[model samples]
Target: MHQPTKPTNPIEKYFSVINLYHYYFFFILFLSKVPVFWHFLSLIFLSPPMDFYCNNTLLIAANESHKNFCPCEDPWWDKSLFTETVQTKFDLYCDKKWIVSFTQSVLYTGTLIGSIFFGILSDKYGRRFACTAAVALLAISGCSLSLMPNITSFIIMRCIEGISAGGYIVAGFVFVVEHCGPNNREIVSALYHVPFNLGHISLAGVSYLLRNCDHFQIAISIPVAVFVTIRCLTMESPKWLMDQGQTEKAAVVMEKISKFNRKPHGSFKEEIEEYTAKRSVRSGHMHFIEIFKHRRLLLNLCCMSAIYFVCGIGFYGVSQYIGQMSRDIHKNIAISGILLVPASISAIFLLKILCRRTLLMITTFLSGVFMITVVFIPAHLTLLRVIFACICDCFFFMAFITAFLFGVELFPTSVRSSALGFLSLMSRFGQIVAPPLNSLPEFVTGLTFGILAICGAALCYPLPETKNIDLPSSLEDTKTLNKKNTLGDLEKPMDGQSTDIDKPDTSKKT
Candidate 1:
């Protein structure tokens, strides 16, 4: 699409150029999400908890004869799918199975911590530094998993990996969104997760081919390493730079983007200076806690955080349960990834016409309905259950995307990173609680997601709609969103006057 001519808004006039350069960089940033999926979901294939039997011949024979549990001293995990894994290597069957879920929880916890830490780092230093540090740490922590001598070390490394992943998500997303014009940010935000789905699809193939846990771990880390090495070529967000009063750096970056897009620079440097001059000077750096000081901001953050939490539970929990449903985990994951495409594609059009709050409510409520539907299906209908679960997942995915976009628009640029980080922390907490749900009965699991989805939908009602609105640049700008009935007030009839519509239609033959 071409940039609008003679755009009045300064942000629009400068960064609205959507051309090959913009597309190219967006794709590059999107590629960064690929490794995130690989590392995040690799555990399913790496240490699949398949059923196993005793390796002892006598115990096996006795169990076969008795048709009961074997009294074998040592258990031999099923290696038909994965040749080597934490489960097989550590004999994590029977009593030790709890460790597997605990490991995943640890990972989520790390991400929870990382969200706040990196949020502050991103806001304080810069998006470029946060992104670079996150990726670099991701490579180190991911590759280190293979060399870990024990499960404890492995879990520790997983936590670190989780931190980097969370940091990358917050920093990277804020960076990309800040670069786009207001008109384009919605589509950009909606489509950003497409690469993540691609990463899931590729993870299935990579894990299917590499079977061994260490090999798979190392394989995924390779891409992260490459990304880290080349990340120096990446640039900081000009909006962020300008917001921080670094106009010269913002000018240079804007110049580069303009040149690459083949658009005239058009005194963007002067515009930046003028914009900064008019902006109110901040008394101090903003904090996530400041959100609590504003009633509307706090309410929005709480409501959005609730939605994000439910999205987390549904997204991560459903995926885990489904990954175990079929014999072919690869096919299951690949199909899951494939399903994400239509949700994202549908969102592009749906988001344009629908209010952000409306879309979130509808999607979340539908997700709950589908999840509850799964509880009614008979146990014998595995295929039917899988189909319904996939549908629920798709709806939740849509809600998840909407939550991100809505949350970004709800807050101002100054505290955007921290606010998003806290929201993500809530999401990670939901994920942390999700792994344990897999151990519950199928109906219980389904019911949990259903209840949470309904609550999430209810929470959406309190949030302000953010469709087609410019990103708020400060707390004062965000407060203006509360002025919804300003036009309505002007249209109201005065005490002594009657509006044409309110008056009797004498011209018409009533």
Candidate 2:
């Protein structure tokens, strides 16, 4: 008769490998952000040129052609031949620029819907399946956009890309956090964006190489293909499987993880069985209302959303306008692209050393300072503008990484994806508003940055620190943390609790 092998403690069996895999997975998912690089490149190519001769020539021509024909000076000039010609040409070149915002809005709308749908589906089906599906969709939509030859097709493809990107981002973050042990969760989450910054840096280089080439479409398509291929080889999150009552499959995944780490395999089935047995009693159906019912969760969500909103405005607004910034500073596209490397490197290091909240507050405040300085730098001082723009990029990237990690840590497992989705939706709202906000007068730029900085600094005071905290495992624990501002009142023994709000403890199970 064959003897049944004993199952090792499931939590301990996979804990170390889980940390390593989380890092590996962070790098893998970072590839998905490559699409944003294409977006960056596309913006750079489309931005108005800053050549001094060309700009002076255009202005001189306008002045000579219509010396006394100011539409503001004489209302009839608005209907005159010259004014009408200029207006028509402007409309032709930038017709429905609002289409960009409208397209983005539709994408966020889809994100709102997909977040709820995928959040539930991920819990039911598993994070691996949902994440893979999201990646496939993102790859297809992103690649399809490269083929667009007209405005309608471009807008449609962009909207579709938004949906896929939104879903992929939410699902990917949730999977990484879920797979990681408490000790490494914050760092893993922060590093999750390294590939994204790398993608941005790579896109800058790729765009510079292909800027004048007619085959720009090919440049965009290549990254999308790479993202899909990489995602196809990735493994499912074992923690997600265990949550869905698939201890047997979870154990198999644990074995694969052990093999990947080249570690000795102990039986993971016993721990899997124990975890599944406990979770099986409670049907894990998360409702939207539950997110708001808990004060701490709600407050955390609000702060996270606000942080993302401000970060989006500062980061994307500055990044998307890099071409303009480059032009104002008289830097070549290649030089501008090269300058982004420092910003990417800064994000990688700063995120590891600083707590998410402190870093966010500091970076955002500094980003505002840089933006205000940019407005005052005389156009003649090209070198000064370049230095300031690079500084802005560094702080912007730092704030972005911090914001991404903050959202991941705030919500519990049950609603992690949903909370991130909602936060992303709000961030997209800022992206939509940023262009108009940026187009405001030079003085307005300083004012806008000042307001955003002040709001972020003030809000940082009340928010709870998440650097060493394990994610809350239950609604009851979440409520206790909210009400008491500490975990002391929770009746459960320390061994039974999965997270400690007061300090970082790696021994706690999730």
Tens digits of per-residue lDDT for model 2 on 1-510?
222222222543346245455557666676666664454345344332211111223454355454333222212222221222211222322334454445555665566556656665666666777777766776677667655666577667766666666677777778777776544555566666655655545655554445432245456655666666544567777766664456788788888877777775766777677655654133245555688876777888787788778877776666655655533322454455556566656765665566666777888888878877877889799778757766786687677777777776666556666777788777777766777787888568656865685587567656665654445444543443432233232222323343334232223343
Q: Estimate candidate 2's RMSD in Å.
A: 8.1
Q: What lDDT does the true structure give each of the candidates?
A: 0.78, 0.59
Per-residue alpha-carbon lDDT of model 1 for 296-392, expressed as tens digits? 8999888888889999989888877667666788898898889889998888777766778888999999999999999999989989998898889
Residue 442 CA error for candidate 2 (Å)?
1.3
Best prediction by lDDT: 1
Judge candidate 2 at residue 120 and give its lDDT.
Answer: 59
Off by over 4 Å in 1: 1-9, 58-72, 281-284, 377-383, 483-510
Local lDDT at 370 for model 2? 84
Report residue 212 deviation for candidate 2 (angstroms).
7.7
* Residue pairs with clashing backbones, model 1: none
